[model samples]
Structures are given as structure tokens and as C-alpha cells.
Target: MTIRPLPDTLVNQIAAGEVVERPASVVKELVENALDAGGTRIDIDLEEGGVRLIRIRDNGGGMPGDELPLAVSRHATSKIASLDDLEGVATLGFRGEALPSIASVSRFSISSRRTDDDHGHVLEIDGGRVGDVVPTAHPEGTTVEVRDLFFNVPARRKFLRAERTELGHIEDWLRQLALARPDVELRVSHNGKVSRRWKGESDLLSGMRLHEALGEAFRDAALRVDHAAAGLRLHGWIAQPAYNRASTDQQYLFVNGRAVRDRSVAHAVRQAYADVLFHGRHPAYVLFLELDPRRVDVNVHPAKHEVRFRDVRLIHDFVYRTLHEALAGTRAGTPSGAGVMPADNGPAPSPASPGIGGMTSASGYMPQAPLGLQVAETRAGYAALYGGLPAQATHDASTVAGPPQALPDSGDATLPPLGYALAQLHGIYILAQTAEGLVVVDMHAAHERIGYEKLKCAHDGEGLRTQPLLVPSSLAVSEREADVAEREAATLAELGFEVTRSGPQSLALRSVPALLAHGDVEALLRDVLADLREHGESRRVAAARDELLATMACHGAVRANRRLTLPEMNALLREMEATERSGQCNHGRPTWARFSLPEIDRWFLRGR
Candidate 1:
């Protein structure tokens, strides 16, 4: 067979396959074009998830009358003049494939006027055929209208989802763009119903406006994170530790103002908060990474969403260290409040919460600052001065003030007393007498492992039981995330998530895993999807799912600090014994360790 050139229409349909995936893809390309044109404000109006109509108007530098026709021409762009410009590309978008690709599948119209022009000129394209250019009155910017998307291609049109699903996509796209450029005023309307809007500003808190647009549940989980390091700057907000959702709807990531899906950065964030947070419960964040353009490559994909950093290891380390240091008490943004100094030194506070002194509750934990800033550590002498602990004894007497809580010694109990048959220490670990010597068990670790396996097996055997949500939970999500959700819809359904796309940028939750009986299903879905969206590709999706299981196991299992009665303890022991891999927890830490009778005797000076 001889090779032949493809027809223009066929060429465009193929391009549409790559560039025009859904209603949201069209929105993304159009929005990015508007932003690249130096738009300070953009308005998007959609009907029927942009399947019926889409209109975008921007207040930015417009195009010349002659350029109006070229705007719909294939490979036409003012973003790059030549190859050299690629090295220093700083704009959010540089590809010229968007307009033509979009117009091929939809009836398209573009009207524009330079600031110096008397009026605007409108050029139309009906399924890639150019309509006559006509004079039109308009502002010194650009307004693009797209109608009857995928009309000529019935196959593509058939794949179009429900109106609700398409609208959800649109909603997600708009909000993420709004978050990326808070300095630009954005307003979105669908079918004449107001959807969302954001004012342009540099203020970090501006993204919080999404709470009003999206809802209070979303706002509560939101947290703010910002820090700068050597040549690399990180700025964004995350949901509070307690605020996590099941889906990845709330996560937004940007690399120099262009939205991205980079797992290295997201994993670092998760690792930084690992110890304190449960699995499955993801931290929702809108993170921005800014470094020299020379150090990053944004040309990896046609969409330009995937990037290759020159020093990914360095980037990873920087993100992890900075996030961890900020969350931990290592780096202080604010001065420590006045407090007593230790005459010399004292044992370090629990690793999880530091700088938090004077237990208000018996748990000895304290909340962070209101703005999500690191809590200022109380100084060494601080405890004495604050009368938190008696000066005579540095250690908190309450830790071991009374006799150890007694355990029942009934006929069911047995002791082989050439030495103590078993001795439980600190009420946290258990020691059992054995013919060889003795065995030690970390109750928390052991139970966690057992619970994790049970959950995994149940998840495999019987799909997650879904509990219906009383009110539909709505959230904004990126298009890539939407694709993942759609692709994994079957799996998600098994997990008890009855999620249907509601817009080009949003998702609606109708149900959740029934096992999460008392959980905030909407929030859980958001967090799960956020984690998947941010870190899914780099890390194994299965591993992330494991983390989710860990989260559920942690919440459902008995806590480490909680005191248990004998029956509860015995039941835990039996469960651990029956468990296949009971030696370690789901996180891979040893659940139990053994010490022989001789070792215990030596510690008591029975042998030297």
C-alpha cells in the first residue's frame, strides 16, 4: 500500500481525539487560551455541559482582524514564533492545536479586537469550514463561542455522558483555573444558573472563596501551606488533618501557574504528614511549585500537563523536608510565646505534637494555630513556669502515678512460675511465658495488621456495601481526575461510591462505602480522589488503596491509648493469633517482639 496524505477533516478528527476529549477538555483549552492572551477577567457560560453551547469572554489583548480567520486555522498560534522560544516558554499554553481541533467537532466562532481597533471582527467555523468574516461590536478582548460539539461525529457524540456528568467536569475545570490564578476574576454560568466565580488577587486565602461557591464542607477541610527554599518555592493550601474526603475532587496542583499532575510532589506532602494521619484519609491541597523555567520541562505531553524536572530527586527532597519541617516543630514561622525554661533539659515531647504544652484534655494533644501555621514551641523552662508539671519531678507523674491497672486472674489464666508466666508492661505491650522463654507484643501494631487483612479480604470478596447519602455531595475536580473516576467507575462502584459526573468540572456523590458507617462520605470521597489525582500515576493506585484501607482500619480498630478490659484484650490476642501475618501492622512495622526468660533474668541481675 502506498502512503497518502490524510484529508483536513479526517486530520482534525484525529486531533480532536487527543485534544477534545470531553466538554471539560474544550473548556480547558479555551480557558488556557484566554489566560495566555493576558486576560485579567474571564467569563464562561455553558449549556448542557457545553454539549449544546459554550461561550467564553475575556478581558485581555485581542487579535487583529486579519488574525481572526487564522484563529480557526490549523497550527496557527502567536504563542511561539520559532523553536528557540520553546526553551523559555513561560505562558500557560503554547500549543496551537486547540482551536482547530475544537472547531473540527463543534460549530465555532471567535470575535476579537485589539485595544487600538475601532470595533471587533467575528469569524466563524462550521465543522472546520470557515464562515465569512463579519464586523461586530465588542470590547478590546476576545469572545469565543462553541456550539453543537461532536455533532458531525456521531460516534464521539454517542460517548458523551449524562448532562450532570458533563456539568461536573466543567465545574471542576473552572474552579482549578480560578485557584491557579486568583489574580484573575472568573465567573461561570451553566444554563443560566450561576455556578461559580472568583476574584483575581495574589492573596493566599482567595482560594477559600471556593468554600462559598462549592460549600462549607469543602472549606472546613481546606488548609493553607506556603514555604520558600533555595531556588524552589512552594505555596498552596491543604485540608486540615481531620478534614479528608474519599475522592480527589479537592486537590489542585500547579507548576508555575499551569495545572499539573505530579505525584512526586504530592507523595512528599503525604509522607510529611504520615505519622499523624490515618490511611485512606487524604490531605486536600492546592499546591503551587515555582522554580526557574530552565529547570523544568513542560513539553512532555501534547496537553502540557505532565512535566519533567531537571532535578526531581532534589525537588522531592525539598518538598518533603519543607512540608515535614513546617508541620513538625523544626521550623518556626512565629516566635515562641513566653514560658518557663527548663533549668537544663527534659525528655522530648511526643513526636506527633510538639510545642503544644499543658494538656487541656487527658489525651495531651493540642491543636495547631488557627491559620495552619506551626504552633510556637514552649521553651525548656516553660513547663515549670506554666506550672504544667511540678518542678520537683521533671516527668509527668500522671504517666505512672498509680499502680498499673489490674487485670483479672481467673481460672482461664495460667502461669508457669519458674519465672513469671506473663507480664504486661505499661498497659501498652504484653509479655507471655513460653517454654523457650518469653514473647512481647505491641497490641496496637498487632491489631492494626489483623484489621487491615480483614478489610482487604472483605473488599475483595464482597464489594464494598454502599450507604446512600441523604443529600448529594458536590465537588470540583480536574479533568484528568474525572477521567480516572470514569475509568475506575466500576471499581469505585464496588467500593460503594455511586459517583456520576455532574458537569465539566464537578462530581456528585450519591452514596459511599457502607463500612464507613459514621464517616463523612463526601469528605472521604474528596480526599481519596485528591490523593489518587495527585499521586496515582507515580505511586501504585493499589498502594494508595491500601493506604485508604489503613485509614479505615485505624478508625475502626481500637486506639493505642485506649485502655481495654480483659475480654477485649483476650479477643485481640485471639484475633492476632488467627491472623496470617500478625507480626506486623499494615504499614509494615513489627507488631510483636520476643525476649527469653534468661534475658529478663539478666536484666534483674539473676545472671551477669
Candidate 2:
């Protein structure tokens, strides 16, 4: 067979195979087109999950009669003109492959009349067979009707899922779009009944729109993150670690207003929450990254769901550091000005921020401030608790004096977030009274976080400690692995591993990090090498060190059932206030909870 040029119809059908996977994909393409056309109000009608019919009407700047035919022609778009334009393309639909692709796979009709045209015109196409453009009714916008989708391709039709499942996909994509463009009004109808509507709000995404798009739960527990530094702007809402989900379904990351799934971004987020979140749980966030268009590539894939950044490491570090600062003391039980709505439909309420050191609550709380930023030898006695020792010295018999001091309800208004500990309940919970309400703390978990943070600080202050092995274990590996071992020797040394290439495909591990002395050294080295080869850096070594420190903190923290006097209890409360991330333990379990006065009053029907 000779090299032959494919016909336009067949070529479009092939593109459709990628651009239009299901009704949802078609809906995405059409809605994006409408958005690019400056549509403020878009109405989408679907039948049988958009298989039978998908009609989208947008009050946008419609095309003239002359452009109706060009609309279905492949590679024809108003978004970009040249290679330089392609590099900085910002519109949602720029490839110009969606229109012709969908038209070739189904019976498509595009009727439109520009603001300047005298009347509307309709162009019909059956499986890429173009029809004559005829004059139609007057209209100042475009209305596209797609019927019998995938009728020409039986295989494509068979791959479609159930109506409900397909509808779910469409709804999910619409919700994502709603998040990015809160200024665009969107309405959806399925099976002839209006199912959902998102009213356009201000340019910012928050309040009712955010709650409707994500959920009320996420909105209530969200923290506003607006940080611009290092030539990038990251702004969005990040939920508290306590209010996490089982999966990353709620994490909506938008790069220049386009939703994408980039591994580097995801990994950065994961690393940011590494020390705070519980194991086996995921975070919920709606973040948007805005940067120079030239620094990122959006035309890497046909679906445009992935992107390549010019400075991936810089992006990773920025996202990680920003989120880390936001969550610094969120779990530490600090009286923060974090906005929290009512969990139920009862009524909206605000969080009572505990003012520190007699400072005004409104003007006092700073997330970036050091919680336990004292200039003490943090690690000298930090791990003593891991050995069943108290985090602080045990209170002497004279320390208790009389009974637990009563917390002030008035007069002394600058109360700490955790308040003063009144008593230890059941040798586990430290019950205290705060100016806002009551606070119950899991002593073990709280101390664990405190001790863990100190241990980490100490570990960082003093560089990694290397434990030399007497035997100097030798391991066999591939030539590539051996090359990596030799190349990354300096990086390995920084991570407290001294590795030397012994032979063509062998390495000698002379020492390892003291914290990971008992771990499987050979396996750990292999994993590190693989990480370095892929990510240009290895987190496994740091992760291993942190894991060891966590275990030490867990064992060293105050044990449940250990009786404590009033002074010891109060001392613990003060330490918690001074410690960062005291809201949860090292493993992500919440360390404390505050029950506002109204919450406690509701239990007893105070007013009613």
C-alpha cells in the first residue's frame, strides 16, 4: 500500500475518537466553545445522557453566515494564529478539533447570527456530510443541536455507560467549570427537566456558589489561601486537616483557570500535609495557580488534562510551603480567626479565636508566627517521652497548692484557644473551660504532636546523624543503579547515607541514618535510587527519618491513664498553645475539640 492522505471525514472521525469519548466529553467541548465565545448564560439540554440529543444555547457573539461552514472545518479556530500564539494560548477551546470531530461522529446542527448579521443561518451535517447553509430565524447568539451521537460508530456507541453514570460525568465536569468561572451563569436540564443551575456571582468564588459547587461541609471548614510570591499566584480554599475526605475527589487544582491533574502538583500537596493528615486519608482543596503563560505548556495532550511546567521544582516547593504555612497551627487548638460555618442547618456561626498573650483576638492571630519558637534545646529531652517520661518535669506535691484554678468567664478576656485545663477526665481527656465555651483534649495525641514537632526541629537543627555499620554491607544492582548510586553520592551523604560504588554493578553501603538503623537498608537504598532517577530528588530518606521520629513521639508522649495533678494539666495546656499543629497528633487524629457556648446550650435548650 502506498502512503495516502486520509479524507477529511475519516480524519475527523479519528479525532472524535479522542476528543469525544462519551456524552460528557462532547458536553465539555461544547460548553468550552460557548465559554470561549464569551457566553455569559449557557443553557445545556441533554437527553438519554446526551446520547440522543445535546442542545446547547449560548447568548455569545455568534458567527456570521459566511463562517458557518468554516465552523465544521478541521483546524479552523479563532483562538490562535501562529506558533507564538499557540505557546501562550489561554482559551478553553483552541485546538479547533472539537467541532468537526463531533460533527463527523453524529448528526450536528449549528445555527447562529452574529450581532451584525441580518438573520440567523443553520448548517446541518450528517456524519461529516456538509449540508447547504440556509437562512433561519433571527438570533443574536448560537444554538448547537447534536442528535444521535456516535450513530456512525457502533463501537463508540457501545462503549457508552448507563444514562445515570454518563450524566454524572457531565455534572462533575460542569461543577469543575463552575469553580473556575464563577462569573459565568450555567444551567443544565436532563430529560426535559431542569436539574441544576449555577447563578453567576462575582469574579471571586466563595459563599453560596462555593458551597453549592463543592459542599457546605467543605466551605465551613475551609481556610482562604491567597499567596503571591516567586512570580506565581496561588489562591483558593483549603479545608482543615480534620475535615478531610477518603479520596482526592474534592481537590480541584486549576492552572491558569484550566483544571488539570499533574503528578508534580499532587505530590507537592501530599508532601505539604505529610506530617499533619491522618494515614489513609486525602485532603480537599480548590486551588488555582496563576503564572506567566510561557512558563507552562497546555497543548501537551489532546484532552488538555495535563501540563508541563518550565520550573516544576519551583512550583512544587511553592505549593508545599504555602499550604504548610496555612496549616501550621490549625490543629494546635489555637484560637484562630478561621471562618467556620454551622455544620448543620441550625444557624451560621463564627470560630472564637483565642487571643494570645493578652493580645486582641482580631489583630493578634498570625498563622505564620512560631507556636513553640522558643530558643531552648528542643531535642535534648524531646524523645524522653518516647521512653515513658513526662514531656515536662512532673509537678511536685506543693505545685497543686489547693484545687484547679477556675477559668475566667469575664474581665480577663484574652484567653488562650485551648483555655486552662480544669481536670483530667478518665486519665485520658483534659477537660477545660474557655471564654468561648469548653475544650476537651486528648492528652496523648496532643503531647504526641508537641513531642513530634520538637523531635523534628531538633533533627533539622542538627544535621542527620549517620550510624556506621561495622560490616559495611555490599549490595548488587544494575549498571544504571550503580551509576545513580555513584552520581547521587553527595545527595545520599546529605540524607545520612554513605554509599560507594564498589564494582561495575555493585555498591557498598558504609553507613545509614541513625534513625533508620533498623530498617531494611538495601531495599531503602533501591527505593531512593529509583526516586532520584525519576523525581530528581529523593523524599524516601526524609520520610523514613520522619517515620522513626513519629514512632518515638508516639511512645514518648503522655500515656493515657496516667494520673496528673492540676499544675501538670495546666502546664500541658500552656505547652499545647506554644506548640504548632497541636490540633492533631502526628498521625492526623484530632487532638482537641471546642464546644462553643451555643453548642453546649443547644444540648440543654437554654432559651427554649
Candidate 3:
């Protein structure tokens, strides 16, 4: 058969295949359009889980009657007009294919009335057949109705899941939207009964909105992050390492107000939590990254759920460093104020409280000691354990002085976050009294974190140690990987690897990070090359180095069932307050937990 141009309806149906996957896809596109139109309030009414009918009304700037027909025409979009506009497009619905594509696959109607218009106009489309626009009465906004989704295409319709499943997808998308735009009011009704509602708030980053969307547990554990630098701004809430999840279901990332999935950002977050998160556990975060539109290409994916960054390395490093520094303040005894709950129907919780006591303030605390000096001063016993004989451990352990007999009362002074140690529980937990209540600490876990952090500081100060290969390892890789390895040789060297291109598609690894020298050098090189090629950087070397340091710290940490004096336990508590990321051990388990006076009172019925 001779090749010919596809008819308009067939062309539209084909485009629909790419944009209209299911009812949830339809909701995403239409809702995006509403947001782009400056909608402040959106109401969605769905029947049969949006499979039978979906009617969305938005209080936004409505289109003119004349443009109503053109709105459903292919490639007709007001979002972008030229190549330059396309390069820096910021709106969510710039492609303009959603309206026509969605119209072709379902029975659709759009009614709108601009604020200045005398009356409203409505346009209808039936399975790709356009109808004339007619006058109608409507509020000063826009309303879009879609029925019989995938009716014209039985194949696509058959692929749709059950009603409950489709509605779940729609609800999930709405939740993501609500997270990014707390300023927009969203209400949903399923089969005529209200299902969910997100009230608009003046503050976009309100903690109440977070609580409502993600639940109280996440809100209580969230650490607000807002930092701007180098033409990029990253702000959002990241759950504390102790509040990690088994899966990444709670991870939400939005770039420039658009929800998207970026592996580079995800990898950076994972790396930031590498030392504190338990193996196989995923950290939960709701982060928003803002950069110049020209620096990121959102048109890479049809659904606009993925993007291509102009400088992946710069982005990766920025995210990693910001989050890394933020998490460092997770030291034990720091009252983040994240655990405080707001009163019923009250204002959003206040920002995190400032540091307490004469110890280092959370905002100003920066570990200044290099490896040997700080460790020697604060943890001499652990150092002795690492170097000296086991018989000498007892002598070194006695060096830590006990607190004074007369401890300062909470009424008279601001106690340290962890308070004063009272006694040791079974030689494992350090029981202490705080201004608010009881503080229970896992001695081994707390010491492990302290030692791990100190070791990292020392390692960072001295730089990575490289072990030269007696016989250079030769590995064959893809041409792209080889090119990346050659281009990033200096970067590799910084990570303690000396890689050189041997052939068009081959590499020679002359040296590797000493910490991972015994591991699979070939596999390591391959993994590093893959990361570099995709993300413009790799953390495999650092991760491997940290693993070794973590093991060392674990062994050097105080073991359970070991006897400890009141002074020794108090000294350990003080060190925990000073150490960065001390709230969790090297394995991500929380090192301590606080039981406030009120909670304890309820447990014992003391108030009653």
C-alpha cells in the first residue's frame, strides 16, 4: 500500500494513545491545564472511578468563545509559539496535545465564561467529532466534562484496571498535586459523595498541609529544608532517618512546581542518608528543586514526569551537599520541635526551636576537631580499645569523670537536650532525666554514631587513600562508558581511582580506593562508570569507604552488658549531644528515645 497522511481523527486517536493512558492520565492532564490557567480552586466530580464520567470545574481565567474550537485542535497551544519559547517553557500543559488527544478518545465538553464576557459558551466533541460552540450559562471559570473514557478504543479501554484501582491512581495523582500546590484548594467527589478535600492555605509550605496530606507521623518527623545558592533553590520536608520507610512510596520530588521523578535527585538523597539509613530502608522526603527553566528540559517525557538536566553533576552535588548538611544537625539531644503536635484546628506548628544548653547550638554547631584530636579528647576509651590491649580498656574507661553530685534542677537552668544521666540500665541503656521528661539511650548505638562521624571527619581531612594495583586491571566497557571514564579521569582520581582509556571501548584501572582494594575491582569500576555516564558523578567509592568506616566504628563502640559508672554514662550522653547525626546509629537505628512527663503520667495514671 502506498504511504499517505493519516486522517485528522486517526492522527488524534494516535496522539491520544500516548497521552491518555487511563482515567488517571486524563485527570492529570486536565488538572495541569487548570493549574496553568491560574486556578485557585478546583473541584472534581467522578463517577465509576472516573471511568464512566469525570467533570472538573476550576475557578481560573477562562478561554474566549472564539478560542474554544481552536483549543481542541492539534498543535494549537498558547503555552509556546517558537523554538525559544519551547526551550524555556514553564507551564505544566505546554504541549497542547492533551485537550485534542483526550477529546478524541472520549465524549468531552468544555464550558467557560471569562470574567468580562456577557455569557458563557460551550463546545462539545464526540469521539474525535467536533461540535459547534453554543451559548450557555456558567460561572466565571471553566468546566470540562469527559464521559466514556476510551469508549472509541476498546483495546485501550480493556487495559484499564478495576474502578477502585483507577480511582486510587487518580487519588494518588491528586495527592502529589496537593503537596506541590497547597495554595490551591482541591476538592474531590466520587460517585457524587465527597472523598477528599485540601483547603487552600496562604502559606504554601504550611505544616498543617503536610500533616493533612502525609499524616501526623511524617509531619512530626519532618525537617524543613530551605536553601538557595548558585542559581538554584531547594526547599521541602525530609523525614528524619529514624522515620525511614520500607519502600519509597512517600518520596515526592517537584522541580519548578512540577512533580517529576529524577534519578539524579533520588540518588543524591539516598547518598545523603547512606550513613544513617538502615540497609534496604528508604528515606521519605517531599522536596522541591527550583532552577532556571533553560537549565532543565521537561519535554523529554510525554507525560512530563521526567526531565533532562543541563548539568547533572552540579545538580547532584548541590542536592547531596544541602541535604547532607541539613541531616548533620540530627545530633542527639537537639530538640527539632518536629515532634510537637499542633492543637486541634490550630495554626501550623512553629519552626524548629533553637538549640538548648551551653553546649553547641544546632544552628552554629560545626564539628571542628580532626579525626585523632577530637576522638582522643572525647572518646579516649574507644580510641584505646582500637589501639591498646583489652586489659588497658578498664584503665582508659575510668578517665571520663562523673557529673557532680548536685545536678542543676530544670527550674533553675536550661538542661542539656539529653539531660543528666541517672544510671545505666542493664549496662546497655543510659537512663537520664531531661527538662521535659525521661531520656533513654542505647549506649552502643550512640557511641557507634559518634565514632563513625569522627572517623568520617578524619577520613575527609586526610583525603582518600589509593592502593596501586600490582597488575593494572583491564576491563572492556561500552564506548560511551569509556568516553566518560576518559573525560572524568580527574573526578575519578578525586574519588581514589586512577582510570585511563586503553582502547575505544576499554579502560585500565591502575589504582582504587584502598578501603575497597580487596572487593570486586572489576565490578566496582563497571558500576562507577555506569553512574558517571548517567549521573555525571558516582558515589560508589565514597559509599564503600563509609561502609568500612562504619564497621570500624561499630567494633570500637561500647558493647552491651558492659558495666558503666554514672560518670562514664553521663560523659557518653554529653558526647552524643555534640556529635553530628547522633540521633541514629551507623545502621540507622535510633540511638535514643524521649518519654515526656505527660506521656509517662498517662502510662502510670498519675494525673488521675
lDDT for every model? Answer: 0.65, 0.79, 0.81
Candidate 3 Cα misplacement greater than 4 A, ranges: 205-207, 337-392, 395-404
Model 1 regions lying over 4 Å from their true place: 206-210, 213-223, 330-608
> lDDT score, residue 47, model 2?
99
Q: For candidate 3, lDDT tens digit of each residue in 87-139?
A: 99999989889999999999999999999999999999999999999999999
lDDT of 2 at 508: 93
Residue 604 miss distance in model 3 (angstroms): 1.1
Task: Score residue 292 of candidate 3 by CA lDDT.
Answer: 98
Highest TM-score against the true fold, candidate? 3
In candidate 2, position 3 carries an lDDT of 100
TM-score of 2: 0.88
Q: 552-604, model 1: which lDDT tens digit per residue?
A: 56554444555543333434444444343444465545565556667779889
* lDDT for position 86 in model 3: 92
By lDDT, the best candidate is 3
- Tens digits of per-residue lDDT for model 2 on 54-117? 9999989999888989988999999999999999988888988999999999999999978988
Regions more than 4 Å wrong, model 2:
203-205, 335-404, 467-474, 478-490, 499-511
